[model samples]
Target: MSDRNDIDPFYDDRSDPVRVLVVDEAERGERLATGLEAETDRIAADTVPTVDAALEAVDRRPIECLVSTVHGPDGTGDELLAAIRDRYPAIPVVLVVPDEERAREAIDSGASDVVVAESVSERCFVLANRITTAADRYRADRRADRQRRRFREVTDAVPDCLWIVDPEWSELSFVSGYERIWDRTAAELTGTPEDFLNAVHPDDRERVRAAMDRLSDGTSVDLEYRIRRDDDLAWVRTRGEPIVDDGSVVRLVVLTRDVTDRKERERTLSALHSAAREIGSADEPAAVYETLIRTADRVLEFDYVAVDIKRDGYLVQEASTLDLKDGGYYERTSLENDDTFAVRSYKRQETILVDDLREFDVTPADPDYRSALTVPIGEFGTFQTGASEVGAFDRDDREFAELLVGHARVKLAQLQDKRVLRERTEQLERQNDRLDEFVRVVSHDLRNPVNVAKGHLSIAREQYDDDSLEATMEALERIETLIEDLLTLAREGEEIDDLEPVDLATLVPECWRYIDTKDAALEVETDRTIAADRNRLRQLLENLIGNAIEHGGSDVTITVGDLPEENGFYVADDGTGFANGEREKVFDPGYSTGVDGTGLGLDIVRRIADAHGWDVRATESDAGGARFEIVGVE
Candidate 1:
């Protein structure tokens, strides 16, 4: 017996030695086993006396190779070989036969190799070599099997479909993840690689076919197209890469992903953007409501859509896709009732989604609707959508509906602002009409009485030189001055009719001549020509000049100059400036600091500036006097 520590010269160190079971009568089995082990340590030989023992030894542990004689004590070597091959197909079996004919017969019956008993001693090395070769081959086969299984596991776990096809696309060599994306098992596409095209949407079939052709021609392709899964269409993005061999295309690998959700979101955003533009352009609330209903219908494809405006404590249906009934074009629901989805959403000021109206405790406004999604358009109204199918609305549907309602809300708020502005404008026009009537009455009625009093005072002066009569004349003259100031205030409040370029250099001196300046000095520091109503400009200059003389005493110097930086002009006086905080009050109609001052002078100046679309502000001049600057000329 060889010691366990003895290393055989023929054994390879790279791999473990092959274990072989030898079956025969006691003497031949032992002799053959010893001879095989003596030739190489790579083959570990064990002796068994019968076929049953050989089968038992093979099953007891890992046996890489089996060596058995043609006949044994209990059964033929063929029986052992058959059993080992049937149970452990990966284990190699080598048969030792009595003659050449028997060796040929053993080889035909699934034997790895055959050795003749007559040449046993001479061919011992050959037998050892064959055993080691068979074991190495078996290990390689096992490694390949494991690699294939791992590949399948990894590919099957991915969410996208992976497939490998020949250059012609006639053979589908490998496929995985097809069941999930295609809604069909991989077996259905095994023999027919082109059958996937049948699932492509009819409109996209030609384009997909062209992409496949490009892949066959050694060109890579990335494509997004729609495919039909049952009755619904799904968007899929596919990338195909050509596998080239020696500069020629051999196969093509394709990866496909289901992108239906991504495509739907993009579509929703595009539709909403277009809807916003249309809704914003609508000038009236009714037009905005109609556009909202139409856009909601086009985007969601819902069975019914309604827009309700909150008016007079009711949700008045302003627009709807439902047919009008009960001799009215719309319906109204009381907002106090929380049973309806629209009212509930309006009160909460948020979005409400009901998958099934029947399951919810609240009653749907439309009994025919089984699902509903309602969104509030701020305090203005509620926008609602409904469908006849239960559970028809999903998270995506609710989000899309909310987006449309948000756009509608913005346009509604704009419409509301426009309405308020129109109403205020009309109210101001009515007040202006009454002011014109008051101005007319003061011009004719009041001036006549003052004129008659002056005439009576003149007769009294002629009859008797009385001091009381002189006082009466002064009082009547004051009344006439007050009437003239009132008329100027009323007339100047209107918009400037026609604008002609007026030179302040000429107009200023002319206005100073009209004002009763006892000893006041005037400086026309500006020579600029500005567009203005000629008559209105004269009135403005006269009032400002008279105000300066009255407030600044008789010897005040008034300066009129262009504010180049301000793009307008300023009227300043070298007199006692306004008291602290009196600049702001000077423009008020009835604000007067002097007892005899009518206080309408500065007020009229502000109105004329406004009619010309100019901004006016009062500040102290450089000489500690009042400065009124009118900017924003153009």
Candidate 2:
């Protein structure tokens, strides 16, 4: 026999032919090889004389099958069969014997076939058929074995966990890459269907079971669900096909993939997009809060949402998705500790998470509420979310929640800045209109006084009279007053940049000296200190006092008193009060009831109050006098 072991057994075409070992007497083996050529054109035979030569031939070449006589020169055919079966089971053996007893013995010894050969020529055809059949089968078996090994090699390199199971799912037939990917051996996971299903996450097992139940023969199933490993949770995408036999389901081949990373990334992206759409388009803080809570419930599925803002040193519930009647307030100082999650989050300027609310220092309003996450919105407030299940929030949930809070904070900041810009723009527009009016009034008022003075001077120069000269001097004084008022009005349009604590008692008395109070009685009911521009506030007081003395009589009692709730201060008089309809109009530029008074005094008071970010409004005093209250003094 020729040594052909270096040759590949699985040739692509018939040119390479199947290799066969013929073990018998030299003449018989030569006849058998010739007959095999006649029987099949794709087989090549090599003759060996004994079991020893046959074994050596098999090791030296890719022998597909063996044909030998029951009696050979070196050994019996049964012994040759034993040697081939022991060392090369994949090589099928065909035995030829001289009688029925030998054929029976050869058949009993596990030969592929036993042929009784009364004459060598007659048995040639039978021997040829047996060798060809055995060789073909051996070739096919080798091809299949190679394919299975190739498949295993490829599957072991991939992340997908491939498995094959019996129809009833009682046992796993095969598994690939389980040990590498799942950090568990295949033996550990191979078991009944219930054993495998038990490894699925409790919350997701029922759905997986339902999907499995719906599967039928010839059907393929695909699904995604969470599963519990030994120590952690993982997301898996499973795909399976049923192996059908005789039109019935026999087995299931499933492929499961660890898709935790992919699922997490997808969830994060979906949550961010949802939050962006919800908070980005909101027009106001209320709308933003509403969208934030609704999106939080939808995205994170939290049980409740609440936002608390610091107002006047008190933590007031700005917005809440919780149904509570008294969403009133909490003392800001009292909750500024670790006792409250919201307070701790706000003071520390960090996010706080509690997996079990019962373990927290503070008492939960809802005993069923188990977990909570609180994040600070800078110095603005605290945003809180609650969950009804223990361990509901994980690090991923915390990260996503913090991202949502960050988006909310940015959106809210934009909204607030937009509102402030709109308010300042409107204020600038109003000031522009007032300045236009001031310019027109100055033009009209100054022209008349100047024209009168010029005409009176001409008359005085021509006639040399005391009355004309006096009239010119009075007209000049009026022009001086108008110019001074215009200068003050121009200066009041600017915002107050510097502020210091001012005592109302001292400032009010000082302003009284600057204004012509006449015999007007001054009453300082309260002595409070407020942050204000000292010079601008003094001008405001002077104008209010002047208006009271001018509109009322010279003896009008001007009373400066504190407003209710410590909100601000009020200036009033015990003179003839304003008519109900005229109170609001009295603050308009160029509006005065008195004949000798310029209408700009009360308007200047309003402008000055606006510059200091104070709210000034006209109302009735206790003495039934005109009252101007300036609130928002802080």
Candidate 3:
């Protein structure tokens, strides 16, 4: 493995003591300070009763950071955040708010980051790491954008989607995945891609047509639309880039993508999250279990449901609502049969599903059964597939038992916390174990192919000196980097960073040098700074610049400037800005414009920005390439 230490992750050392001013009333201040000190030896929290005292202490000593209550005896953490932003911008600050409202306030007041006091250690540490990473990345991207801005025009022009439409909207040019996406030849849509957009859903076409015309009129716009195709509507995301001679737009060049799956996943996860949070807060376990069952049934498209708790080898069916249930549901209870579903789940500590239990003896005494799901209830539950299980994902008496089992393991963890304090501790430990195992599994499984491919490619490149061979090797290495990124995201913990003022104009250029793009042209210029994670800022730059070089063409130029509406930094390139239908899908994992990328770069950029409380998005660049603007830079 290449040593990242050689890369100089910006901060020479993060081990320096976290100089913190903990503001609170006398008793709570000292007690929480003591707890924080005990939580980490690296933290040196000095207790203070008032915001004035905290400010004085910050001035007295070079306070590296601040960790205080949202509302102390004297003032709130926002007061401290504003004070620090205005006065001691060098020092990072994090607020230890009790709930979401205070966290929101901290975010609004320019506090670096915020964590709930309930989850301080896990959340705060994560925040701190992210804050530092964001600061570094922001610096790197600025540098990279500057370097990319000096390149020639071919790199910018060739990779473009290059759509040109006349005043009547007849297409003149289109390139990059046009035929494969529309399933029609670009020659077929020459000067009339918008006419072909007759397939656009009525409700979306006006906005879509308006955005297209706006871009054609020299004003760039990014839009999402539902295109009517065949007999159905397909979602398309497009970012428009205009070719202008004067103030008027003569032609529109747009990049597009089908974001159907990503949007669906986002919606599903949102619904699941809301349901989970609401159910989790219920005063009764039965209500929580009921909420899970109904939500799972409706959202995930499950057929049947049965929740049971086993004690002393007896079945305590806590919740039972079959998706196909009628009045006679319990009359066919073969679940507790001697050789039945519940019997297997309890005996083997696994979930059992019988797709067709009619084959079994329903002899009243024997109890007949069919498609059934029985899951174990325990904090340490592991819903292993039974050896006697049938097919996987088949209509047959398959391991559908494991489906409910899998989700039940998660639900079981949730239920475990409500048992008792001692049981709650055990459940927490078990949950931690599961999370650790998940992280390890994802890392190891992902890294195996990535490392193997890179290692073998390195060996191949050495053996074959051909340019084509070298090019292949380089692509392989990029894939490996992408895989490694997946592991990085999984490993990232939750925490807020101490807020610090960062100079992006200086840092963005520095990170650009790390890329071995000597053969590719480089130009960079920027004069903007903001509040962000230093490292993530650089990653965002690297991803965006890398994207330009790869897709916008090998030679590109990067320019960095500021946004007026929001104190933000812009990294613009002269590359394929964004293709029609791809403006948003480009952010999805494994989604890439180029055939070579593993598609994790922009994702890392966006996610790191998310963790740091910023927005990184793609837009039309002044250089006629892709533009990535980190908004809310301050």
lDDT of 2 at 198: 74
lDDT (C-alpha) at residue 498 in model 2 = 92
RMSD of 3: 49.2
Tell me, by TM-score, which candidate is best. 1
Write out the backbone clash pairs for model 2: none
Order of models, best lDDT first: 1, 2, 3
lDDT of 2 by residue, 196-275 (tens): 68778899899888767656345688999998777988899988888888888888888889999888779777868877
1-634 in candidate 3: lDDT tens per residue? 1122224334343455555667667787787667666766666778887778877887776555666666444556667777778876655677777788877877888776677766444455554553444344434443454444423233244432334455457646435555444556666664554555666788877777777666655787887778765676667677767777776666666667777666756666666666757665666566756665665555444444445555444554455554324532332233345554555656676555545455655321212223444555543322212112232234322323343334545555655655676787898789878877876766687668767877887788788788987777777666567657766554433333766667766776676788755445655455555666566567667777777778776667667677868767777777667778778787787788677677777777778778777777777877667788877756
Tell me the spans in candidate 1 whose CA falls farther than 4 Å from its real position. 1-88, 91-136, 139-143, 166-170, 189-194, 197-226, 235-256, 324-330, 358-360, 366-370, 388-390, 428-464, 487-586, 605-634
User: Residue 621, candidate 1: how far off, in angstroms?
Assistant: 9.5
The C-alpha TM-scores of every prediction are 0.71, 0.50, 0.32
Clashing pairs in 1: none
Candidate 3 local Cα displacement, residue 523, angstroms = 86
Worst 10 contiguous positions by lDDT, candidate 3: 381-390
By lDDT, the best candidate is 1
Tell me the lDDT of candidate 1.
0.83
Q: Residue 112: error of model 3 in Å?
A: 71
